[model samples]
Target: MRQSKRIAIIAHNNKKRDILEWAEFNRLFLAQHELYATGTTGKLLEQELGRPIHKLQSGPLGGDQQIGAKISTQEIDVLIFFWDPLEQQPHDPDVKALLRIAVVWNIPIACNRSSADFLISSNLMHNEYQPHLPDYHDYLERNFQEHAIQVNRELPFPVGTV
Candidate 1:
């Protein structure tokens, strides 16, 4: 990741105020990095920070998936998602997938204000850091080979003759 990290911020309905407060407190540091957020959150942040934010759809409207895609493509370096754990979200699967993808891509994630503070304040945040990416090539190859074997066994014709 670059010194100027690409940070994605998200907040549940119940956590919006908290996120806004946390964001306002770190406005100066946040201004130095690239900012992204869901629809409503992005608008609020832009107004609060007086800067541009890359806004996507609302969280329930596919914003989480969009952020997941960015994480997979290495477009986003950090995720500050203040999700409401007690409240059940209608789009829970998407939220889960977003978290899964972040882990898969080995990006830093902050689920609450305390964690966000720790993450943002870390020395690594200001330096060019390379995160460890999980190796999936072997897993992919193994699955493909297994599928081929299964297909061969299911075939009606003899292996050499077919």
Candidate 2:
């Protein structure tokens, strides 16, 4: 099994209550590790869990983007976001980006209550999950060169750098 991990929780306005209720039910299991969430969702979960959470901006205001960056950088290991399917949100694109990133990174994601339940109940999920993140200097440089040449205009990569 893995070690400890950073987890991000997010919810749509309409689904905030559901997330809160779910968190409340599993507070003990959740309290053991790092927690992050969007503004309102974090606030509500903190209030319900009586624990501190690293809160990002509101979803529409870039909270989702903040979480996305964290996940992309492998700063987040688990993503349990309760999205509202019936309602069209202004931040749908952000949600899609986050979901896509999660998939690309092979991080575990729970989009609904049932999957969330399965995750929280799993021994591996609750025990610990540590990601082995190595130096990204070369990786970042290569990616930047391939995808964002402008972003690396100021930096230089050494020969055979890893």
Candidate 3:
């Protein structure tokens, strides 16, 4: 990760005020990084912080998936998502997938105000840190080999003889 981290901020409907307040309190620290947010959250944060934010579609409309894609590609370094646990979201699967992708990519994530505070205040946030990336080559090779064997077994002749 670079010293200037790429941070993605998101908030569910009920938790928007909390995230906005937290963000406003930490505006100076947040301003040092590249910020991204979903539609309404982006607009709100931009107005509060008076800074430009990279805005994506609303969460229900695929913003979570967009952030997940960025995480997979190593374009985002941190995730601060203030999701309401009590309220069930219509796009819950996307939210879960986004969280899973963040973990899979070994990036830092904060789900609430307390966690976000700790994340931003950490010394790692101000410096470059190399996160370990798990190798999936073996996994991919195994799946491909299995598929080839299955294909050969189902065919009238061996796969290469065709």
Candidate 4:
């Protein structure tokens, strides 16, 4: 059997219904894991599933950042976010950053019902799936080396010289 994972669920205003339906469809599978969500989404899901959820603030009020922080700290194993592409959010940057963190952490993220279905049904969800995470320390060291080389080449130049 797959290990119980910490799953975060988030949905935009327009995509809430879709997420609710998808969650309902996967209730059994979801019940086997730890659940978390943003404000309205969390309340709605808790009511629908009759299960407790670790609720955070509304997205615009910092929920996305909260989740991102958790992802950075390896607190979340999966992300199921149904964001509305047809709509614009005031916290768009926060949303993007949250997604970026998930990617950087090599977490499994599902952006839609289809992908959610696939991910939930995949054998990896129930089993240990080791992700190939980037060696950021090495990358930072390489970047520092490159920056030093560039700085060395630009040193001792005349102030007004091209």
Highest lDDT scorer = 1
Candidate 1 vs candidate 3: the lDDT winner is 1
Query: Each model's TM-score?
Result: 0.94, 0.78, 0.94, 0.86
The lDDT per prediction is 0.96, 0.85, 0.95, 0.92
Using lDDT as the measure, what is the rank order of every candidate, best first?
A: 1, 3, 4, 2
Better lDDT candidate (2, 3): 3
**Candidate 2 per-residue C-alpha lDDT over 1-162 given as tens digits, one digit per residue, 9 for 90 to 100:** 245668899999888988998999888888887899999999898889998999999999999889989988778889999999999998799989989888877788899899999977777775655545455689888987776656455458644465
- After superposition on all C-alphas, the RMSD of every candidate to the true structure, in Å, is 1.6, 6.1, 1.3, 4.2
Clashes of each: 0, 2, 0, 1
Residue 153, candidate 1: how far off, in angstroms? 3.4
Model 4: lDDT of residue 9: 98
What would the per-residue lDDT of candidate 4 be over residues 52-143, giving only the tens digit for each residue?
99999999999999999998888889999999999989999999999999999899999999999999898889987776766799988999
Better of 1 and 3 by TM-score: 3
lDDT of 3 by residue, 61-106 (tens): 9999999999999899999999999999999999999999999888
Give the poorly placed runs of model 3, Cα more than 4 Å off.
Answer: 155-157
lDDT computed for candidate 1: 0.96
In candidate 1 the C-alpha lDDT for residue 123 amounts to 99
